[model samples]
Target: MLNLFKKKEKFILPVSGDCIPMEKVNDPVFSQKMMGDGFAIIPSDKTIYSPFSGEVSVLFPTKHAIGIKSDAGVEVLIHVGIDTVSLKGEGFESFVQQGDKIAQGDKLIDVDFDLIKQKGFDPVVVIIFTNNSIKIEEKLHHGEHHEKLSISIK
Candidate 1:
């Protein structure tokens, strides 16, 4: 019966990138985990994918960020880069429309790191679990992109 009450499941990385601890993020809002408890990705690839199977909740007009509402009821926010909204949609592309159902790893957007760098923006993607009561199954990330990111929801 205790096993039935256990929280256990995994959430995969949306894109291939270096996973950085939320503390390493330069922004206080993210570094402090104000958004939610999750890590950031210093992208090794320019493409952004859905981290969870969900409907696209928010896709910024500037293409710098996206919010997803998982079928499981978890809300995920993927913010691409720091202070990048100022770029004004210069180096990003969106593949899915708002309300589109997405499976894990589905391509959502593409980014031009070269352009972002030239314009002085750090393209570190922040993945935040928006709900306040979220409890993670695993608490350690060492910058490795796994086939699946094991996480459990309580």
Candidate 2:
């Protein structure tokens, strides 16, 4: 099949916002577990944007998570925080619904960072590939409070 010759694809951050590395969670003081694949440290409270160009594949009923399918066939899952999905959409708003076409930096979800923290949850956004078998190259920018994170294929 022609599929065999297709080049490996890459996915980049959907938005221009803060990013944190997951390795920092090893400290007990943070008391957080890396639930998924990628790590991001968000320093401010604002809108969460789409990291890649794709259709809104899945929007959690709780409004705490979103899934997007990139044009290159990469599925991206962005969870706002650990267990924040349990909030059931409280203090959260969904800007895009399933089947909606979206491009990088498009507003997808607006989360109440204060309310998230008030609820005793950390607002570390996580971007992960739902299909792990796909080859990916992750690019992480170091330092605290950084904007403009990048990712690509191998």
Residues 1-154, candidate 2: write the lDDT tens digits: 0021143443445444566555554333232432344555564656787766789999999988898887877676787776787788887888889999988678888888789889888767666655543222344455554443334322
lDDT of candidate model 1 versus the reference: 0.78
Which 10 consecutive residues of model 2 have the lowest summed lDDT? 1-10
Q: How large is the C-alpha RMSD of every model relative to the true structure?
A: 3.9, 5.7
Give lDDT for model 2.
0.64
Runs in model 2 lying further than 4 Å from the true structure: 1-18, 25-36, 132-143
Cα deviation of 120, candidate 2, in Å: 1.1
Predicted structure 1, TM vs. truth: 0.85
Q: For model 1, name the residue pairs that clash.
A: 9-151, 10-151
Off by over 4 Å in 1: 1-10, 135-147
TM-score of each: 0.85, 0.73
**Tens digits of lDDT, candidate 1, 1-154:** 0010233223568777777778889899999888787778888899988866779999989999999987767788999999999989889999988889999779999999889988888879888878734544445466665454445445
Each candidate: what lDDT? 0.78, 0.64
